[model samples]
Target: MRDERSRRAAPHRQAAFDGPGAQAGRGGLSSLTRRIVVFNLVALNLLVLGVLYLGGGRDSPLTQYRERMGVEAALIGNVLEVDPAPLSPGAVAQRLEAITLSPGLELLVLAPDGAVLGRRSGDAGAQAEASRTYVLDALGGFWRVFSGVFLGDGPLPEGQDPLGQARAMMGGLQPGAPLSRIAEGATGRFVTTLMAIAPQDRVLGAVALISPLAPLDAMARARQERALRIFALATLVSTLMSLLLASTIARPLTALATAAEVGGKRDPQRPAPARVRIPDMTARSDEIGRLSGALRGMVAALYERIESNEQFAADVAHEIKNPLASLRSAVGTLRMAKRDDHRATLLEVIEHDVRRLDRLVSDISNASRLDSELVREEEEAFDLLALLRSLTGYLGGQAEKQGIDFMTDLPEGEITLRGLEPRLAQVFVNLITNAMSFCQAGDAIRVWVRRRGARVLVVVEDTGPGIPEEALQKIFARFYSHRPASEFGTHSGLGLAISKQIVEAHGGVIWAENMRATGTDPTEGPLGARFVVGLPV
Candidate 1:
């Protein structure tokens, strides 16, 4: 039997010890840490992409290159305007080339008659040679595609370089103002600045400065590299911080979930497992901490209830056995006895035992079902004083018939309370009747109520032999009785226990104490037994 039980409990035992990793194996409570880190990294990268796009569109290196080229072109036109020598194609070209131009610029001089004078390369000849390398061409191609997609610009037209494009625009046109434009090239784009070299409005000629956009492309690449490096560092830091936050949340919640799983299983035929301790997170002062405290409290209540039920069952068995054994002995005696009077006495003994057994069974069944009934019942506001008046009026008549003084000191007007009325009525009824049972003829029983702050107190006092000091705490426990010998078989011990269950279910308290003559003398005999019930009002 032991081996079979162990086999049945093996899985549950394993479940109790399972950690978050084990739960994750079963796809339970997935890692919030991973999700947090992933989301932060993704958002960070998106922000970087947006910054790159916006920065490249409005304030790009290409824009700066055009502005610089325009300034250089204006300066060159000024230099040509001051020269006093007659214009010639060779002279124009030679003079222009002598003036050092910014790198990657090509200079062209046109005659006043619209004849092609001459063209001279600045530093462009060397740069053009370098630009033809496979590596440079490939890098320029990549930059062109990248700028096209993200910066809302497209590739340059085929078969057209910046020089040819500028010459075409300058043909058959007389400039009235300094003009700047972008021209496409085979390998890249260019910034072209045009200025009329007309000294004193006589139109000496026009000088065209064409600057390659390769340097701007390099600037853009460098900018992008820096941006990416910063993004990577930010992503790393944000992801680590997210992981730490997730750990604070996920680990404690996981522990709580695991504890709930282990303790929450209900098996009627099996004994309860060892108590599971929920992790204490109450110091956090957050929602998770509140949840932890609530769960711990719930588990404590559940274990206490389970232990109480186990003890109740054992007590039930023991109580029933006493009556059963008495009846059995009585029956045997009745069968052996030959005298009529002896047989009659044996029959009465058997009857009393049978009655005792019946009472015990009835009370046991009611007590067993009390917990569920208390949970299922709904509470409503009612007049507490009115309910007490009704009980005292009805039970007082019964006390009078038994020659005992029944008194009530109930206050006037209604004291309102919210609770299951019938259940609370049962509680008061049990307290009054139990007190009456302890009292004899000529003894007095008093039932009274008093309001104290938010609570209403109900006291039941009887002028009978007070309970023993040792039994005061145990009086409300199931099957615990302190009645006289003659009263033993006549009453079941569940009345006070059931009363306590009902009172507590309504968020109230019930306690028994001996009423003494003076406040503090332990040697003095108790005047009577007093039962006090306090309920929220």
Candidate 2:
């Protein structure tokens, strides 16, 4: 039966785990994995851009270059103005030779009428600074065009001296006033400042200082290239690491799901798989491990329940067959009997068999429902002493009427317990009644209760013919009856089994023992049968 059930259930279980819906869940990248990689890349790329694009402070090279150009232009104008050498080319050249100049600078001097006076070109360092590699020059050209088109960077005239353009733009100059501007030159961009040479409110000529912008552009391009290399490398490494991490997580999860599905697969030759061996991930110390452990336990419990049900069904079949056979025999014998006394005897046998069968069937029904009832019922706190008092009070009179002594030794205060009240009552009632059935006119049945540390113990002892040593263990088994033939049909033998089930359901234990006259000697004659029940306080 269990095998048939498992076989029938297998395909449905497999479909639940491996169907289209499950495939869909496994198809795309996990959201967590996507978020991990994407968010990391975004932050890293943003940081790279911020560091590259964020310009320098006031003390940057460009600001210092502008200041230096202005100071140099003013110094040149002052020198030419104070010369008193008639502003001749020879005098200006001699004066320029006497003044010190910084690297990467070109000087232009003009007469008051806008005629060229003298020119002092840049030194060797400025010439070296102007040189560029093929890659850099191409990149620079592309950048200029791109910026001009998209970033609104205006193009400078290709074949002109930027200082000359500055001079042309500033037609008139005021004394002691310097003007600075950036303009494209024949070679590259230049930062130029024009300062007027004047004395006593009289305007003379002007001196213009020019510095190349190529050095700054080259430095920026080199830094940007290095930054881009780092960004690309970082993104690649991070992406690979994120994917590896995601695989570690998802692979194990997928394996677990697959294993779970495999456990439910149907085999034509076998009832169930040898075992549903879920992967043992308990050592992982994570939620997956805990889940694996929980699943393993549940599967084990389910198999145990299945086995128990199969055994129960087999036992029920075997037990019902005996009375059914007897009933069939008695009915067949009755029709053949000619005498009335013989027919009457056959009828009595049939009635007895029918009653026994009815009792057996009723007990089996209750036993079958016991497990579900224990699970479905709710437990509440109740006083154990009060429950016992009510039982002993009602049952004691019945025992007295039957010429048997019924005694109870109950405790004083409230013995509170949390459990199904009616189920527990059924257990004690069964125990007490069984003791009563064994006892006669002179025999005594005593029920006692006591608290034992963390647990409460209840004992039902009977002073009757004690249980046989061989039958003691088997007495609690299903359909196992050891009563006298006179009371054969009165008891179904399921009472103790049901009691054991109820006790175990409440996390308690029940056991039967033969009470000996001497505690230390095993050879001593048995005095009575003792049933003990222990429950948590």
Candidate 3:
């Protein structure tokens, strides 16, 4: 009764949810998928951010502006060295005014004494004022970028324009002077060139040329913006696709977990459900699909075994009750018997019942352990011929003592087999013993082994009466027995069942059929019973 309760309680113990998901409502899909989606999104964001920072900050395309400024400064210095003495600030200004130049260039003329000569706006300076405003905006971008770092976001310069400070850094009225300025995001940039106006080998007035970088900076900024937009769009698409993949992966896994939970759930206060139907997910072409199939198969086999065990237990109880009742009846009758003959008969019946009970209990124990042994025992190659030779040599004497003829027809060469050696030996022993028990004096029992293709066959045959036609189909069922009344209580019918179990576990087959002579009459009986066991070589 305790064992029965424990067997039913096994499923309940399996369902115990001391794990974290026990308290949650629906943990299957979200639990696994959320982590995947979050990790992918974080990685995508980092990649885009890294690309943008590197593309815009230190590796911008605006370096070309500085190179052009260096060329312009060199040109001015060469021209001033030609005639410095004849070039007054006024003459140089009048000469500069007559010249056509770049639209973004501005000239700041100064005398030898470092006094401003002709600094007022003209055609070139007029063209520059608008670009100068652009430079101011670019400076604002730089200010905001580094405000928290170098500047601490302090007060802005009151009267000084950002571009004016950039120009002042180039030095005033200095000949052959070169300068460069650029801002972040390629928003604004410029270069300054200072030249001495000399007509002779004397120092004269100086001329400054300022070039605007508005057009080039604008182009670079546009290209950077376009690149960033493309990256953002690609990132968005990638995230959506990642989510789809996670859902595709998670849905089937969720179904599997849900099915397992349904099957395993058991309440101590109530019985478990009779069956749980697992959802089939084998259609998918991936590892998850294989996992689902394997789990379904494992669960199905487990339930089948459990049902078989329950049926076997019930059968054992029914079979054991007969001998137990007989034992009880004999014990009761022995106390009342008075005559010597009556006492002797009662004692003989009691001993027979005791032996029968002992045999039945022994068979049942071996039958129960067969399944576990077959699964737990390691298999190895052994010489089938050697194993058979040893067993037949040992058991031939017992057959002789019973007045039965015993012989073997095993092949001479080694017949190697891979299986549990002891278990196979047990099977052969059971079959040979069974044949010996059924044989009569002068009856020949032959044991033979032969190989065909990939399988080896072991046959044990007896010249005793063949199995009754009616019992052939049901003979391998547990506890099934059919014998003459004289042989009753002498054998427990578990031998064939245990033999079949062992054979099948080794990927082999065992079957019995009556051997008939050639050209026999239809009404004639079988010559003998033949049991053939086929095992893989």
Candidate 4:
């Protein structure tokens, strides 16, 4: 049943089904707009996310802590430099214990060999100043957080003091170099400031101040969590906006596709069905709207071409069958007719039918090839007046042989036009040839050209019998020739049709009308047939 239905409405089925698969592969016209929106939203969201996640705007609490430590270290150094009584590491440690700092800071006195002689925060006179293990014990909450198991009960890794690494990079806090550096690691964050305790221009020891980062890191983590929440919210909002954008673009596109599908749909139940109405999206001042309008127009043109091809095929079969029947009859009669005169007559008829068939076939071949030939040919700019003159000069000789005067009245200034020159020339040559066919010895043919604003008009008029009112409109149709019976086989009817095709391909217009003399007498004689071709200049 499906196959039967398809066979009945093949034209519509073929037309409507065109390009749908390709359209699907391209993900619909709206996909372009949707992808664009999604891409831009994703890009902007990533940029916002990076800024929020990476930018830590908090002031370093350790920076201020280092300032305080520097001041205390300076005091200790001054005491050692000019106290008039030399101060030892024990005296410096005692002085550092008196100079109180923030809760997470500690002061240490180290000898030149990295031996901690004294520390102010813990047991000062005991084992606190001997090694960096004391600093590791001070890692506290910041240490577990950096170790990636914030609340773990397991023992912390040994030899993981970030401050020790900083000291190593600084060559053990020796004298003669400014002693300030910040160290950060999975263990913790800290800042160290060291000053040489020089007496009598000789370095005796170094006083060190260390600030822990547990407080600052806690504040930073809190800020980051809040920033992450804001970023997530912004991303959610952007995603919603992108969906809205997709809908706005996709709605119109869906309408267009549906309209196209409907127009092309085949229904064997309904014969001679009209094309489905396409939505008019041209009112929108956007490229998508323009695309909708163009697609609608292209589909309409395709339907027209389909109908024209069907009619042309029917005409061709009908036209060819007539000559074929005549040839068959002539050959059959010639075999039976034994007399020389009758056989000669039959042979003449056969020859005439053969020539008629040849002409029709040749014209049809040219008509079929016209479209592809026009596409392959390149357009060029040539002076319109010069082309017309050249055409007249060549075809004028042919017209003179028939004793018809060929005249041209062109504008003085050359008119330049851009188009396939040879194709356009073929149009004029066909027109002139057609006019000559309908004229006699005394009848005059005139080819004149003039500019009309943005358009150039070329008129080919003949002083022969004017075309009948009924036939003027139909003359340009394929196989539509009005000639005497004597001239029937001599001229193919495709001349005017081919001419029209060429002119239209150049974005020009061609029309025919009977020329009426404009004079005092109202019933003056009709002058001739006027075929005007108008092209953009």
Candidate 5:
């Protein structure tokens, strides 16, 4: 009967999206690893572009020209200091001014105490001022280039020179401090280096070498733009690939889900639909491949279960037919017998055979309908305490006839539940009957109801020989009797199985346990089993 219930409840059709093979393809693309790969690729491209921007254009001729100008200025300063025919400061300043007339160099010379010793122009210390202005311009350009490349915006704050900011950021420079680059705006990059004149490692005044960063700034901006383009392209490509992958993976899963929904109402006569196959990703050993394998295995198992259930149903029908036919024939023979004594004996035999047939048919039928008929249909709110009181009263007579002490410990107040009353009654009856059957004279059957969280638990406990662990699970199987039929008389061994089905169908659970009576003189050995049924409130 349990097997039959499973069969009737099984979906009639292959699930539209049922197979694991289909699901494997559907979810594989959205996994974390794929996302990480795309992220890392984009980051690497940006990093490569940054490295090139910083180092690639340093060897340009414009940079060399700036370096040569600094060298020429230093040589002229030395020549003007020569003995016996050295030029005056004004004459030296004029000579330096003559050289800068060529192009791209702003020259100035400072005395040891920060005074304007010589200069290319005389605009009230104009050469020194021009040199300082160039340094500020160079710092601004570098700041602009650096900021644009990194922050995607305008220059650093005005007023604070970029080179000075860099110096401050690096914790105030000493002589020969390393050259640094900073951005001035979208249009410039500044290179700043401290030039120190020293005699035997004792430092003289330092020249802050400042170069206009227009060329490097342009290159960096170009590199930054290129990096953004590459990143955008990579992102677009990765996104497309992810979508394609996700679709490939999700399609099979969606198909499987659809198939499962359809299968729930499918007719058994039609063959199960073929499982959707995932494209073989065997060239790669990854989650997708594993998922595909799992899906295949699940489909195979489903097929086996269906086939097994079909064979089992056929076997049950075959097993019951002969016994039923014999019972029918025996009843016919008993009715026709003429001698009274012989007729009585035949009648007894017929009765025995009829009982056997009744039990067989009942158990088989109940097992067959277990899943469907036991399913709860009409749910109504009812007091569990009241229900137990009524059941105890109904079964009290039967318990008394067997000389068993029937008692109840139902807690006061309504223990309400949302469930089918008839199904609940059936479950209670089955448990009470089983306890009554096993209980001896003077033995007790205790029925109680208690509330637990969102569920109401009804426990039927008895004092009798406890059920063995080995037979515990099997006791709920169709025609599975723990004691011999001869000892209990003929019984359809489907009561517990039916009770289990009903409880489960109502979204409840039932389990049995052997417990010792508490507060006894010496805790008694395990008494009869306790069956606990829980139903949602």
Candidate 6:
């Protein structure tokens, strides 16, 4: 019972494994769709990054905080410049208090060494102490935490204190340069500026404007959170849309694939299914619609061609039967003749008729079987140069017997190609035999093999009266012949037709051209023609 269950489940498991690989085999369209979707998503991400990099600072809340500090620095710098007097502690405090305003500002004057020189605020002493102390103390704590989060945690190295660093950076500024600028510090970001208080730009002291780091930090965190939320939302929407789109697109393609596989396996008598109807795409002029149209056209053409070939095969078989019967009767009559002389004459006539009948039957049979037999089989790698060498050796004696010179321009390297060897050999034989028959005394034939791009080209040139220009295109049609009755003594007119069928079967092309004799190349005499066959590698 366990074995039976496993056996039953095996097909289903195999089917599951085979499903994706089968879809992958549907050619370029499947790969093209996936590439398009991935490219779209990458482009969207890059657009977002570009927006952040260029415009992020202009919209940040930190810009407001920096402007407020700049106003205070300007006021302090003006007072020190105009008075030019040494200020006592009380006088300095009074001077700071006079300029203080509501929504309030705190002032601190620091000596160049960073010690506090004077401090003043608008409110009562205790209240002022509470606000001032809170703001001032929060500065270092904020720096510690900010440094930990953003700039990284550590004690200041010797000569590397954050405030001193700010002053040193500001010292490089030219007179009349902007007094305040934004800088990111160990704790957080700050708006720092310097003022020339002593005469002739002598450095007596500096006023530092401090703000708490929370408001700007909070705004930035919020903005980032909002951007992340938006991104998540967009991704969720895109995924849902992708699922819907993939299903919509993949379902029709899956149906088409199933139909094609079924058609391939079906017996000729079995009727095809009703045409598949894909929704939402029929009315639109898009790639999918064009694809659907092309498939329908292909199925119709295939059915017609199959029907025509079957009917033609039946007709050919029926037509050849009568000629074969006559030839058999002639042979029987010759066998019964009594005298040698009588028998000899009768046998010669019978043999001549038999040969004619045999040629006719062979041509008819080849014409009927051409299409079906020419269908592509397995493709394998083979050396064209080696194949040509073998063919030349086989046909060389025949050409010599006919009093024709046989020559070859074959290279030695292995020109690797993918094709059915037997079919290719058949095409080569037909072309060479046809050339040999027309090649006259002192005439020569040359066979050349070379590689061009991803295709291998073979050319057979013969010194014979070239085919007329008008006959070139029609030479490959069934039963086509350029030979008049004078030349029809041994010709069946089916060789070129069979050669063409074989060439087209391998997805290659063949054509003929008149070769002009130039200078001393005797092989390319005035009457010579060249037949070239090109096959993909």
Tell me the TM-score of each prediction against the true structure. 0.72, 0.66, 0.73, 0.70, 0.46, 0.47
Query: Model 6, range 1-537, lDDT digits (tens) per residue?
Result: 323533644443211112232343344335435654566567667877886776567555666566656666666767855666654566666677667642333456655555556765444333221212333345568988898999886755332344554466455544333355555565555455555445456655666555445445655655665665676677667656655565556645654565566545546675854332222234437666565556655665565565456545544554456556766776787778788898888776667666766886778777777666656367688988888899999898889888899999987779887778887888899899888877788899999988889888999999888878788787876555787555643555677877887788788899988887456564543568899999987
Q: Candidate 5: minimum summed lDDT over ten consecutive residues — where?
A: 122-131
Candidate 1 residue 89 C-alpha distance from true site, Å: 9.1
Estimate candidate 5's alpha-carbon lDDT, on a 0 to 1 scale. Answer: 0.62
RMSD of each: 7.4, 7.7, 7.2, 8.7, 14.5, 15.0
Q: What is the per-residue lDDT of model 4 for residues 211-319, given as tens digits with 9 covering 90 to 100?
A: 6666555565555556656666777777787767765566667667766666667788888655655566667789777976788677767776766676677778878
Deviation in Å, model 5, residue 354 alpha carbon: 3.3
lDDT of each: 0.76, 0.79, 0.73, 0.73, 0.62, 0.65
Q: Which ranges of candidate 4 are over 4 A from the true structure?
A: 1-84, 88-100, 108-155, 159-171, 174-191, 199-201, 234-303, 325-350, 411-416, 519-524
Over 4 Å off, model 5: 1-315, 318-322, 325-340, 355-359, 373-381, 452-456, 464-470, 483-489, 513-527, 535-537
Report the C-alpha displacement of residue 431, candidate 5, in angstroms. 0.8
* Regions more than 4 Å wrong, model 2: 1-237, 262-277, 517-520
| Candidate 1 lDDT over residue span 360-423, tens digit each | 8988889888888888878799999999999999999999999999999999899999999999
Residue-level error in angstroms, candidate 4, position 3: 30
Name the best candidate (by lDDT).
Answer: 2
lDDT of 2 by residue, 154-246 (tens): 755676677567667457567787877887777877787888877666666778777778887676666656656677788898899877876
Among these predictions, the greatest TM-score belongs to 3
Q: Candidate 4 at 197: error in angstroms?
A: 3.3
Which residue ranges in model 6 land beyond 4 Å of their true spot? Answer: 1-38, 57-60, 100-105, 112-117, 120-196, 244-284, 299-303, 329-359, 362-537
Question: Residue 434 error for model 4, in Å?
Answer: 1.4
Residue pair clashes in candidate 3: 83-198, 83-199, 84-198, 84-199, 85-198, 85-199, 85-200, 86-199
- Which of candidates 1 and 2 reaches a greater TM-score? 1
Q: Poorest 10 consecutive residues of model 6 by lDDT?
A: 13-22
Q: What lDDT does model 3 reach?
A: 0.73
State the displacement of the C-alpha of residue 31, model 1, in Å, after optimal TM-score superposition.
4.4
Q: Model 4 Cα displacement at 189 (Å)?
A: 5.6
